[model samples]
Target chain A: MLKRTPLFEKHVAAGARMVEFGGWEMPVQYSGIIDEHNAVRQSVGLFDISHMGRLMVRGPQAEEFLQHVVTCDVSAIPLGQSNYGLLCRPDGGIVDDIFIYHLPDEFLVVINASNREKDWQWLHDHTEGFDVEIVSRSDRWAMLAVQGPGAEALLIQAEESGAGSLHDLPFHGVALSSIFGYTALVARTGYTGEDGFELFFDAVHAEEIWDKLVGLGAKPCGLGARDSLRFEPCLALYGHEINDDINPYEARLGWVVKLDKGDFVGREALVAIKAAGPSRRLTGFEMVGKGVARGDYPVHTLDGEPIGVVTTGMPAPSIGRPLGIAYVPTSLSAEGSEFDILIREKPVRARAIKMPFYKPRYKK
Target chain B: MSHNVPAELRYSKSDEWVRVEGDELVIGITDFAQDQLGDIVYLELPKVGQVIAPGEPFGVIESVKASSDLYAPVGGEVVAVNGDLDASQEAINTAPYGAGWLIRVRPSGDEEEGIMDAAGYAAFCEDRAH
Candidate 1:
């Protein structure tokens, strides 16, 4: 049986179409993709993100252990802040993209649901000498994302939280607080390209907070809208954009690879990768022809020579046009460079465009 | 099971529906098919005057998350297409039987042999559930 989140019942009650994703039965959509997607873009929306792995790393050598395992400069992260980082193999291939939240006592490492077991095992394999303990907080917490332009006002209107005026919380900042009388770790971070907050609270209170948020006009959105929201901003999705065979540089995630921080896993290979420059680059494109670009579609040159493959291609709801991301040779990845995407054996014309098809609306 | 399967129309196990009108066969994907592929955003149809074969793909449907083949239940020469769908494919989700119709075909006579009644298709769709 596929695993269900704490809010699974809520999703079913609202008539969401359930689908299997990352070994869990998740709600793909409720009120339809376009409607929910526009809801988040134009107003506030709520999402159940409990299916992701929630973990805590603590002990005397916790910081050192993380600094060695992840590519980010973990030592630089102050308490109440988080850093987006990646776990890489010795060959610099990406294991997963993670968010490391530096709390007062422990570090909260949020990982993808599909990579949860593998990431946990990877962490354990590296704990030979480090005086640290890795604890799975998945069962203890239910995660929710309150996102969009109006999210701040909704949070401010809510009662009883030590975070004290969400407007004061810096981007990527976390605060241990009480929300609606329940202890929660509220973080000003989200995957959507908008101002939002992710709350980690007790699993038992899933319905309580979810209902309250919905009552307060936060439209209940599902995975379909969530994927579209992230797609517009070109945020890297694991398994599609990044995988064990793809390095951070190839995935356009080199910014997260802090090599100067000294000797993390894959540091040797990443240093070489950065020096030599990546052979292929991840680039964005807009379809000029009449076909919707689908993932895994083969890409060919105008002369019919196959060059690369598409990672993600679709009609973006926000952009009002068909856009996609693909890994092509660095030579053909520049702006105005044209390629042919073979859709059903017919090559459709596409032109490489500047990345981040849509600008993010995060609070600066 | 709640999907609308009109009894007057014939269905193919591949989820396409056939409605015979005079010498022409009006075809569209079934409601069950639209539901299977949620929120159809794009539909690619064969050009008018093009020939098609039964059980072969004559079009493609791209939903929000997936892209699937739209097969021909009864093949013929394409005479007309729902061109307005090029801008808005959501009609396939909202009105799968009417405006969602893909192509109007001048039947090739030998193409309707393998189709089933609505009850048989509903049963087939139910069987796949388990």
Candidate 2:
């Protein structure tokens, strides 16, 4: 049996297409994938990201414990700031990519829903000596993301309890603001390439806040749009772009690894891996001939020799073209490199292209 | 939601509709099939004069969400192909019966081996609606 988010009732009432995702019954689309996708790119869209695992790290050695496990430098971030990081194994394989926010009394960590139990076990096993408390708030809190080019404009109209301007908040900044008569954690962070705010609040107020946002011309988007929205920005989706066998170097996520920060879980193995140079890299390509390259499809060189597997592939709604992200040999991970994606046993022509298929519309 | 299964035509279990026009037969995905495959973006149609085996996949149809093989409902030779779908395929979602008709075929063998009328096809669809 699959679990459901707090807004499950509201989603059903809206006639959404519900599907099982990450062990949860989630909406795959409402109006449609293309419609919701265009909403995020053109105006603003809202998403029920409550399926993400929400964890809290408190106690005296909270900062030290986080620094020791994550690849990013947690000590560098001040209160009310968030940093994107990754949890890796001792062998430098990615466990899961995460976003950690430095709060006043505790640090909030957001992780993938499917990896919630495994992540908890990994984090718990590592806290043998540190005086830190790992608390789970997965069920008590609900997360909503309002993203797009006009995100700020749409969110600025929301009922607020703060006196300062939201535009003043820096990217990756966090604030405790009163919304809908309750204090909610509003973070200037998101997975989509657009400028957006992630609102974390009590699960009971899920429908109230979601309704208000949707009533304010914010399109209700689902996981389908979420996946496509992140793709145009080249954002990595765990289990797709990165896995237990893929490292930061090969996944084009080396920027999140702060090897000089301190002694971390994967620091030693990452140093060795970086020194040895990556054998293959995640490369982007566009279909030069025909057919959409689906996931797990074999990619081959022009000579028809199988090379690697496609991680994510589809017709990008924003770019209006069929694009794909795949792991290719180091020799083939170059611009203008030619390859073939076997779509239903037929070799279709493709060529390596620059990533972020469409130019990201991020606020400066 | 109920699907639109024309009473005048026949349907296959794979959700393809066949319209008998004198001697030639018109083929296209049914409304249920198009609804199942939302927002089609690309389509690979069998060429004119190509041979189609009964119940065998003859071409490919893909939406933004997923893809599926277009299995022939009857054993025949492709007489015409909808070339317009190669450039724009949204008609499959908007008009699965008219403009979205995929191919026209000249029958070669028994065409009623596994096909069903509108009433039988509607009940067949009802049984699969979980």
> Comparing to the true complex, what docking class would candidate 2 get?
medium
For all candidates, state DockQ relative to the true structure.
0.67, 0.67
User: What does candidate 2's lDDT look like per residue over B1-130, in tens digits?
Assistant: 6899989999998889999899999999999998777788878888998999888998889867788998888999999999888777888888999999999999997563678999999998888776
TM-scores for every candidate against the unseen true structure: 0.96, 0.97
lDDT of 2 by residue, A1-364 (tens): 9999999999999988888898999999888889899988889999999999999999999999999999999999989999999999999999999999999989999999989999999999899789999999889999999998788877777748445456777899998877767778888899788888999999999999999999888999989889988888899999999999999999998889999998999999999989987899999999999899988999998889999999999888888888999999989999999899999998999999998787766665
lDDT of 1 by residue, A73-180 (tens): 999999999989999999999999999999987899999999999999999999988999999999789999999998888877664753456788889999877788
Residue pairs that clash (backbone atoms under 3 angstroms), model 2: none
Candidate 2: stretches off by over 4 Å = A162-164
Q: Write candidate 1's Cα lDDT for B1-130 as tens digits.
A: 3779899999997899999899899999999888878888877789999999988889888887778998888768999999988777888898999988889999887564558998998888888765
Q: Candidate 1: list runs displaced more than 4 Å.
A: A161-164
Kindly provide the TM-score of model 2 when superposed on the true structure, using C-alpha atoms: 0.97
Model 1 Cα shift for residue B47 (angstroms): 2.1
